[model samples]
Target chain A: MNLDLRIPMGLLFTLVGLILTLYGAGTNGSPIYASSLGINANLYWGLVLLVFGGSMYILGRRGQRRMEREPQKPADTDSGAARRGH
Target chain B: MIHTELTYVDWIIMLLYFVFVLGIGFALKRFMKTSKDFFQAGRALPAWICGLAFISANLGAQEVIGMGASGAKYGLETAHFYGIGAIPAMIFVGIFMMPFYYGSKARSVPEFLRLRFDEKTRALNACSFAVMTVFSSGISMYAMARLIQALHVFDHLFLVMGWPLGWIFTFSIVLSAIIVLLYIFLGGLTSAIYNEVLQFFLIIAGFLPLVLIGLKSVGGWQGMKTAVASIDPRMLHEWKGIMHPATNPMGIDIIGLAMGLGFVLGSGYWCTDFLVIQTAMASHNMDAARKVPLIAALPKMIFPFLVILPGLLAISIATPHTTTTVSMQGGAIIHETNIVPPEVEQGRGLVPAKVNPVTGKPMLDASGKPLLDYDMATPNMLLHFFPTGILGLGLTALLASFMSGMAGNVTAFNTVFTYDLYQSYIHKNASDKHYLAVGRWATVGGILLSICTAYAAINFNNIMDTLQLVFSFVNAPLFATFLLGMFWKRTTGDGAFIGLISGTLAAVLHHGLSLPLEAHPGIHGGWIHVLHTYPSDMAQNFYTAIWAFSANLIITILVSLMGKPKPEAELVGLVHSLTPKPDTGHATWWRRPEALAVLLVVLLVVLNIFFF
Candidate 1:
């Protein structure tokens, strides 16, 4: 799977799982509360953070990989080394 | 006359516990080969030990005593302080913050500031945190001493001391402080971690029995439920009664306060405080550091049930009629109006006239009238319930908690002093040996300062209240600067420094000025009631955190824009560094969208069911 798609998918599943756990724990009410809200508040917020976090993680990794694959400027290397020391 | 005395078994248990603790410190001394070893445990602590130490360091006399008191007063809602107030922040620190810190190999939080910003910001933070550590340590010591005296374990030591040991209070404080100091000074962070692991187990063992026995005594879960129901239905509801203006002093909106506390206080403490971070930083690798919080999170979730539930149970078992009145040592009652309910009141003078039909103990009021002081509720429960040997074990467990917390604070102070202050400023070219020596001296100084602060903490009615207030006034300001410095490249050292100082000043001034208005309004005023009335419980903390954070963000942004921007290279490097590498594996469950989504769901559900 493409890294971007894979990361977001993984995050989606995790968010769903989190929502389920929260619902079970009584953060969201049993089925009754969900009906009142006309939407699952637990599942909704849970999925948001999950998907966002996962997408960010994946995007962040892809950017880093792209940077690494590109030719390194000598100046970049020296400055990177110096910065790392500090 | 009836004589109450500690048995041989009690003495033996106490002796063994002391020796075992001391032995752990001494044994780990050989590991103190370098300054790093002493301060950061050679950066080799395992994830589990770090996690255990983190929990133990936090579970001191202040938490045990204050949480118990809160449990007696607030019921299940007190768990929010432990669960929401503590856990999420810890998870954030473990998942996001620690990886950055450990991967970079920064020795202390202030040192991280020095790298990210400048020396002035580092120094400012170090000084503030140092003052805070000393005060916190002192409070821990004082609580330990008070608990010891209350237990009356030293009544038999008169012969050893001579002169009827009139100085037991001073003696107990000094003795406990010295023992804790000796181990920490000898083994540094390594000993602290090792001792904390043991103490963590001991505290659990000590409290578990109380919960079990208390549950049984109250006639199992049904009985407990019925007893509590008979007293107050709010006792079972975790989130009800939390919003009442009378209970909370600062007139804080509970939802806002809970969120602010969870995000700001949690992030600041778990991420920024060296006392907690030192444990994770001591891990063998970044993975270990990251894992520490996850490993620790389980216990963190479970402990409130063990510690706080018993206090609630104590409330259930204590009868309104059984409450005794408090009197001054001079045998004079101070006042009648101070009367409190008997079941909740602890020491003399706060309850209506009453005599304990069982013990024949006179319950006296401040004016020799019978009154109950609910503060004594937990202690009275302990005295009534536990057998002699178990009581000694419980007392030792309490002491273990104090020692563990004291050791963590002392070690952190010493580390910051040795690394940031002493090595950096005092003796820039000092050898490893010299640094190690200074580290020991710093530990000693930290202990002495803590002892003094502990004595002062005694005067404060509630340790947790004082601690929360201190965090609001001090640490909340630092959070803005640290977070912005990490994420926002535009934040200059000048901006960070100015924001921190201004935010702190605002919080302190607000707290101090608000006190008088809260105590007595000059006029029969309606506006005063709306504007000036603060929620009595944690409103100060909520208000301080909000205002302090706002002040910090505003000052930082305003000052930074006016100042020259950081070099593009530096800014780019910082931003780039924050971007997680694919191979680091540090960006796992925590950063996973699914996990956070699930967590939020859980959080919302818990809030809806338990809170709303």
Candidate 2:
């Protein structure tokens, strides 16, 4: 399968969000950490994973669109025709 | 509360459950018209049923008993095994792996291997997986039998059969085996799936009451928390406390170990294992197949709440009142705390005498008398805490768990035998009728073998310890081969085959050699000092997996590089299947990319709060 860079990129951001949320939550008790983070750790990490998984999916769809725009190869056209015959 | 002695009604209830399972199998026989229908449920299972079956397949008797033992021993961190170890791996499988397996019109994982690689690879993968399934089935059988005996459901069988108490284990195994076999034989995957769905609902209904009643008996969640705190403050901090050497038997880093196991063994079980993949493979189309994973994820996410929380509650109720006692063996005073209370050590010859401060007599009960037994603590709690009908439900749930797990193994075994082994090697030219007959026989054979294994499993001291050992031994290496195969295109058949064999052997040797040395470091101080102490069996599993996979990957890549690469066209089918398509268009059932992205963010945030 062709690599979808969009999904991987989205996943990277999601992972970062997760790490930040974990950092925030781990320091929930300390006033300094809580004020700086502005969100509890649990919600933060949850949000991060959700976003990461989500973005990859979106990027995957977008990559699919770009690939569709490219000119079809002779081999691809032949296979498509063969499938139609079957 | 029902008496410790199970009444006639309990036996009747148990029998009814068995009959109901068998009945479902027979009832679903109409769906088994074609080989495809029998093996893949005609690729038409609904999302909810598939999801339930997926969860049910994973929830075996071993999990229930093992989780209980861990909760008693390790406090709340034990829940991580269920939550993090199982749930996330399942979610990953659903999200990522499902699309690949289900989208491809493959009958079994071995079939996929055949498509991706060659016949030799398919045969090797199928046989290895079959062996693992048989071994696991045996373990599950033994665990379920032990639970039944504990519940005293086999006293009648002992009398009727003119057998010893040991026969209770036999009876339990035979009963479970026969019931599971009857269904899988008659209905195949369709029967297994429907039964699993029913069993899943029954198990949940059965356990919910136990948790609720247990909490009520313990004076609610806060009271339970206080009880646990009074015993050990560390119990509340699930993560940090889990890291302690005393808490984890193997003494390895918890998160690292769990995630490693998750990546390797978890991927193999959820992603590549035919038993799980078959459920999704039964979907009518690619969209339905895709839906299987996401729909399944919801149940996987929720199961720990039912299975693991009750264990934590059990620990909270039992911990504070726990006591230490001396054993007569070497006049050794074992400082037992949490779960093993003084009241528990009345009988069974484990506990030794301690003089009373005032009475100058053996430490006794309220009447200044000796206690009976320590092992009855969990059982006593069940009888006292849960109400009558609810107790039946709890026991039934436990039994349902066994049925679900066993049925999955049996179905997978039958599929492998019918398609890969029997049809491929034994009777390549056999008719459909002949193959179907053989499939039924294979199911029966699987049950009998598992029963024998279960008998052996019972002799082991603790069920959970045995299960972890079994999983680590097989899954670690199996995971290595599948992971490499899935991603690395250059890996040749010879390399794949050799790597799998070598990785498996290495993992077994490491587990056998390293485990004993770790357990008795005093006897082998030199070895112990050199080899780092691993924490839980899960950690050892991770270490073994890493070593095995590393060895396998290196060998596979090296050998492949030296040999010929697979033709590009050969891999096109697999590659194209995974490639997302634009013009194909999206269905309403498909999660919106933006919404999914948000959910991913939320999941990560939740994980960080708990994990970090």
Candidate 3:
């Protein structure tokens, strides 16, 4: 629970975004775009993904910094151990 | 059978997803130190994380594929499943029910029943719920594997490796099962919830573009409406021609839809079903737990656009015939064109007819008309629009949905099995660490059992169908039992147990006596005798749910009158009237549960009106 979920999520999107962006950029104006109605969808969607991925990464890092500044209560972890059975 | 070639980039995107999920599992391993952490994430998740996981848990492959199929068959009215059916019940649960669940401090839903009722009721619920989750996860796996097989996604690789083509089904099933098992086994509920949140975003990222490209192809909303109207104008309206079962695309009137889907099935599944409620219960505080469902309602209300719009586009758009030339390994040239025709028949559209595999001919129904395979709508749209790179992303989105759903069920199953079954009855005095070990083992057992069921599904499709039908019977009347137990303190354990049994029997009896028009008496219903005929199968289903709910409600009241009630002192937090009002904390008015519920209700009304 200590791990900020957005960190992994951000990393994932960033990686996928980078892959698609590069692929889209490389494949620009190729006949492969014909299936997508002559739209360079890989490039456009890649940029959109890159933006989304970047924002999540930034927000996650910010959250991690804030969490480090204020340590969590020990009671938070103890509650789970204490309440073992109904 | 629309098959597309995938580029290596697509494989990398997919492989990266698998790596990230497993990475999350490994990262969270140290945090899962207790049974509580493994089963319930130590009840420490923030509301937003819990909120997205809440809906994502239920957004399995079947939900995506099945909703799209329903959209093609029932058209715009398919939104009723979300608009009327899911939204209200979600709000009701967040505002009214979460306090009892979160405050009572019960570890599981069945445990809550034990606190409020008795041991018998809890045992019944726990056993049935545990079994149901395993089968459902298996069904999800089966459906995904079948879809992969049908799409021939991995056939080229199999062929290149000198493997038989049939190995794709087994390969896909085992690969996905292993992936789901590893993640949940390593990190438990926290991993599942985190992965679900990621899957939610991925689903939007993948499908939003599909909808956009599709709408553009079909000329946007107005254009799609015009095209669909040419086929059947009724398909374009949510409420038009819904006075009678025969008129509407769903074959159910407003009363049936409202009572059966909205009140009965909706509340039963969304409110009481452990799969969704577990996500909310994992919240860090009571206030966040209360807000979980409300926050989920925001995305739940608008999902029709991302999931169902593709079906509309599939049925509406006329994909122009354009040849794509391909060179075979033997140096033979082949040209491929669009499989879905531009002009479509009413109620059929782009969906192809089911074929008899043995005869290699279209399968005929009782009335001699070929049955349509409407499930292809969403997949067809994916193939119709996406090129190679984006197509990989789209397929990965689908794979994400399947794995998320499987993990959700496995987590729910393991929790119930370890806590409600193993600890309660099998080994009451086991240490927390011992129970934690048992929980991990149960996760493996659950996934392995699901794999068996998946193979069972592949061999005997009818058995899976019957199992699903029986599960629905058990589920249909559950909301009534939960409603009475939570609101009325007089509800006794005996009454609940008997009420639930009779309610399931009522569902079976109703289904046995009725049959849908133009259908034979079998899995579709009328096993006992055709005492009644519904206009369509959907109408019969709704009525069956309504009957089951009514029987449970009335019978529970009557049975409770004859039995002694649980003492009121013990029922303080379990019953609604007895529990103290939950504090909304120092959050502003807009952030409070009530305020958010109200906002969601308003949005629901606007959506219904716009679609109406």
Candidate 4:
């Protein structure tokens, strides 16, 4: 599969989300959240990012599978027309 | 007041963040097999990626630090930069100018100048841009270093080593520069782009919570507004005192906002400047290129709330009551002092509050006010809101934002040096491999130059002032040359060249010859030939842009009319009237550039009306 951004971004987000989530859940009801007005921002935002990142990973995986099945094509480098790799 | 509350957990988070950033750079190193991957990200980036990257490229210290600084100092006037100054110009670029950039097959903005104008014009822009990028990179580096010092991020280590504060500051800057250099040197633009996207997320994750907590602490927006109203009623509205330039905090009203900032500075930056444009130019197709800035505008419009709200909230907690002197006009406190206080090195508004001799703590004023350093708005907000690990993440996010800005400029500089200056002048028939090698060398050279400029940033009192000075010198007149050349087929190369040079001279002369107003905030360091100062540095900037742009427009039109025009056949795709529009086939409402442009423009109008 190509180096699609969704895959990497998803992976990174999921990793960070998991870390934040686990730490936050373990440290739930701590006095620290008092500074943030009693909101467990880490746990909440981590779950949000986890769901977002997971969906992105799924979508990227589907795209990668489709690309693998399809025939490869060369970039449109036709002269007189602007194309990639300029 | 909130104190620096970093802990072991925060250190772990930061360490992990660094690992992720460097790991991505090293992982993407293989993509650097060709210059295409390094410089242009192989021109295969999706619109959303490039769009985020475009804003993130500029999401540097200037955006966060300077805007927050401005928010604290000027209150709602800072929004004018986003609404009037940025949105209109960005729309103009997306709907009108993207064709010449994406469709004309130009590698860089300077290259586009060469295509449309003469060799001299391109060289002029290329040289100025290269120098500007380095200087800007240095400013971001300096800001990050300064923030680190002000926030006392490495105080524990510094205290342990018994290091002098200056040495610690320098070390912070060098450390930032080295990290940015590593990433850019490894994966080049793709790494920068990917990191920028990450930085965007990190910034939101870091700051959004801070804003929410800040608002909650301050008793919500209305409560904060009422509190700020007691300090200065003018702080609550965007267009307050805009009719009178002197009395207003920004020092210019409708004319300066509309003509100077919106027209000259706005068009000059958003249209002619190549830093952000380079990101948009990396889109997968012309349609994507057109959408890049448009999509970025969606976020750009909302960004003021993210960065500026922190500054507005700062006034509620640490009131600008002492040290940072301001004049009361129309019940708003317009800043009287622009330089950093002698007692503080962090530049621009860190005034000391009087203390109670009995307890030796900060003494309250007659109105029972806290002493404030306006420049410390965003930093203090972070210090106040988060605890331990979360604080570390926020600091890392701030650090990431600053580095992304530096990387953006460095990457842009290397490409311009490679494609525009080196290929066109130094070495003509070089292989792709040879050029790639030069690009890497240029990257190193750019970082070195930026480090030198970062040291120079120490002499300046404010980052925003220095940036405005650079804009006045280079970008102000650029849009005139661009507008005339691209639209008017009659514009000649010689005419364009003469107009550009003379216009730049006009900007310099206007600033130098004008009488210095007492309210002018910035002290001229390098260009100290000032006859007089304006009431404010902001006022001087707007007037300079106006004069320079007018001179450029008039001169270019006259010269073009006098000179022989390039043949229409030769100017087909370059000029608007002569060239046929491309059938981009992006017919869907959201995908179409015009649809987005129109929607954004409507939003801008609604915003202005509301603000008015």
Best-fitting candidate, scored by DockQ: 3
For all candidates in order, the CA lDDT equals: 0.65, 0.60, 0.86, 0.77
Query: Distance from true position, residue B124, model 4, in Å?
Result: 1.4
**In model 4, which runs have C-alpha deviations exceeding 4 angstroms?**
A67-86, B157-166, B318-372, B459-471, B519-534
Q: What is candidate 4's TM-score against the reference?
A: 0.88
Q: Write the per-residue lDDT of candidate 3 for residues B181-288, one digit (tens) a residue.
A: 899989999999999999999999999989988888778899999988887788888877778887888788888898999999899999999999999999987778
Question: Higher-TM-score candidate among 2 and 4?
Answer: 4
> Which CAPRI category fits model 4?
acceptable
Looking at chain B only, the TM-scores across the models are 0.84, 0.82, 0.96, 0.88
Candidate 1 local lDDT, B534-556, one digit each (tens): 54536655666777877898999
TM per prediction:
0.75, 0.74, 0.95, 0.88
- RMSD of candidate 2 to the truth, in angstroms, is 14.5
lDDT for B315 in candidate 3 is 78
- Residue range B444-512, candidate 2, lDDT tens digits: 888887876676665654554555555555556665555566566676777777777777666665655
For residue B360, model 2's alpha carbon misses the true position, in angstroms, by 24
Give the poorly placed runs of model 3, Cα more than 4 Å off.
A73-86, B1-3, B319-350, B364-370
As for candidate 4, its interface RMSD to one decimal place is 6.0
